[model samples]
Target: MESSRNLKMKFDDLFDVLVKDLTENQPADTSPALKWFQQVLLYNVPHGKKNRGLTVVQSYEFLIGEKKEMSDEDFKITAVVGWCIELLQAFFLVSDDVMDHSITRRGRPCWYTVPGVGLIAMNDALYIESSVYKLLKKYIRNKPYYIDIVDLFHETIHQTIVGQCLDLLTSKEVNLDGFTLDRYNAIVKYKTAYYSFHLPVACAIYMVGINDERSHQLAKDILLKMGEYFQVQDDYLDCFGDPELTGKLGTDIEDNKCSWLIVQAWSKADNRQKEILKVNYGKPEECNLKMVKMVYEELNLRTVYEDYEAKSFQEISKLIEGIDSCLPKTMFNEFAKKIYKRNK
Candidate 1:
């Protein structure tokens, strides 16, 4: 991959162009509503690792190949679609923090938790979601695949919401009986996978004018597996990762999330171990956290996670090798490599 320094410089340039389009280019620049809108974009978007947005551009590069360069306008359009992915992510996070009652995000207070924002953050979140279409309409309205691209965004947002619903319900009462691998798979596939992995590649696929169902299906199957594996890594990091690096505090345990760690640990625990978990698993106390973590250690859950990681990587690699399509193997390989051992 190119240096993140180079990627950020490119993304930042496009971000300025987008800001102007939303503000000074269209409306009265001095309007208070425009000012608040600008603040929303400045604070919530572009702050994270930019992985999903980057994936859109990189995947398109792989599809377009070195011999056939797109027009400069086409290049900017793909990059802006990538930015749209980031905007959608911001929308999810701003609202998710409110729903999850989260404190910190990206190393600072969540939008909802920021003083003076409160419930107004909900409207801001909607604005962020709506902005994705606002962007697509302006930049890509004339493309043949414009309708397809719009439908893709609408479907992805819907799938992610469904996944979020499953997550909230699963953790509602913290009864360990409901924390199954099947349940975890569903949550990750919709909540994290569809948007993070599937949507970006699919967006690029449509951009390149490949509208056939067979190609899309093949890509989705492979990418969904990658998404599940990525979330597994995320679950591992939430507990063990540095808060300074992760830029968010881990609350999976306290929040009764059907996290990969807790579910795997539960399945491996003895009756006595199970009883210990039942007593302390979802409690918010420090002692409770230690007690649950101790069980994970005794079970060697970290080792279990490492083994799963290696196996998942191999499985995905093989799936890519066996694919039969115009979609480049290098694109899938690049994506697999990016998420395989990521720290943040």
Candidate 2:
């Protein structure tokens, strides 16, 4: 993998081009609506690690072979499509912060939390979403797979919305009964996996002229499973990881999130442990947080997580091994390795 510095430089270049294209045609008068729209795009669309967007370009290069020479236009178009995926992510995140009542994102105040922005962030989120198609039409409307690309984006966004709805319902009520492993899988697969893992690679696949129905389904199967494991690790890290390394303190316990740790701890708890959890699991108080952590330790949930990681790695390996060369196994392997054993 390239250094983060190199990756950031490349991604920033792509983002710069995208921002220019979006704003270059603005009227010279610069109306308030246009100004706010520019700020919305600038602030929300390009922040974060940008791994999801970067994956699209990287996966495509892997499929086409790094040694193979790609034209300047080919490279730029792939990078722009990658940025479009990032715009979609920005759309989800801006609205999610509003819905989740989150304070900060990427180390700054969320767009909605900024003074005077208020609920206007909702409309800004929609604008970011619409920009995805705008970028697509501007860059690749003439490509053979243009319609397929549009359809894939539409489907991925819809799947993520379904996952978000499930997550909202799960977290809407603070009942422990609702936090099941099955529900957790559903939420992660749709909300996080489809867009993060499946969409990027699927776009690359379609771009490279490999559109076999069976191949797409097989790739989805592998990627969706990888996405589930990726999210389970995210849940584990949210509660158990070091805040210094993670860049944010975990609120899953206090927030009553349907986290993997809680479910595992619940399943392993004794009667007294269960009662302790019942009293303290979702409380915002420091003592309640302490009590939940104590129970998690008693249940050895960290070890359980370590074991799950091993099992998941093995499963993904076996699946990748079984894949025929419809798409390059190396492409999927590279993607999987990035998420495997990640701490943040």
Candidate 3:
């Protein structure tokens, strides 16, 4: 695997340039407000593992192959596009923390919880989202594929919001009487897969001049499955990962999340086990969380996760094998390997 640290240093340099531009372009007298706005933007962005942004550069590299050398100007432009994806991610996460009533993100206080930010964090989130388009227009507007890139950004945000709506709706309708595997899959695909896994690479493909329908469809098919496995692993980690390393306690059980574990447990549970889940899950107390974990252990949820992890790896391998190597396999393969057994 390539060093994520090395990729991240390059991203940080790109991020610094963007911030400097935003700062330098502010109104002469009201620089303080710009500083605050910039601070909010910078703080919220750049804290992730940089996998999404790096996927853009790596995918572009794969697509271009050896035909064209990556010019310094090319690297800078692609890095900006990658940063736009990161900004979009920040937009969702800030608002999501508020919606989830989460207290922390990336190990700091959630933006809404910071003193003096409060509900304004909602606007701040929007500002981050707007910056994505602004940067896109600034850097890529003259390119022949400019319209396609703009359309992609809009489509990705729309899909993510729709998925989020499904997720919120599912949590509200957790009657278990109505829960089914299909519904669970729908929630996963929309809420988690599209933006996290598909959109970033798709954006790079468009940049690399591979905007044809067939190429897009091929990338989406593989990326969406990768997205599913990514979220499934995330669901698994919530229960079993080290909190010291993962940086948060598992909340899916208490939040009544439509996680793979819960879905599987519900599917296989007897009537009595179902009743226990109904009574104990989502109770908003430590004791209730303990009860839920107990039930999970009783159901051998660990083994279930292990089984799924192995199966997901195999599925991804098969998908990659089916891909024509003429396409950018290294880019997608790099992403797949990083998340396959990620601990944090």
What is the TM-score (0 to 1) of candidate 3? 0.95
User: Which tens-of-lDDT digit does each residue in 253-338 have in candidate 2?
Assistant: 88777788888887788999989988898788999999999999889888999999999998998899998766788877877888
Query: If both were scored by TM-score, which would come out higher, candidate 1 or candidate 3?
Result: 1
Candidate 1 local lDDT, 1-344, one digit each (tens): 44667766787689978977776655565588778888888999978888888778777778888877666676688889999999999999999999989999999899887778899999999989989998999999999988998999999999999999999999885579789999999999999999999999999999988888989999999999999999999999999888988999999988888899988988999998899899998889999999999999999998999999999999999999988988889889988998888887
Q: In candidate 3, which residue ranges exceed 4 Å CA deviation?
A: 1-4, 28-32
Worst 10 residues of 2 by lDDT: 1-10
lDDT score for candidate 3 against the true structure: 0.81
Ranking by TM-score: 1, 3, 2
- Candidates 2 and 3 compared by lDDT, better number: 2
Prediction 2 TM-score vs. true: 0.94
Error at 232, model 2, angstroms: 1.0
Highest TM-score against the true fold, candidate = 1
Task: List the global CA lDDT of all models.
Answer: 0.90, 0.85, 0.81
Error of 3 at 128 (Å): 0.6
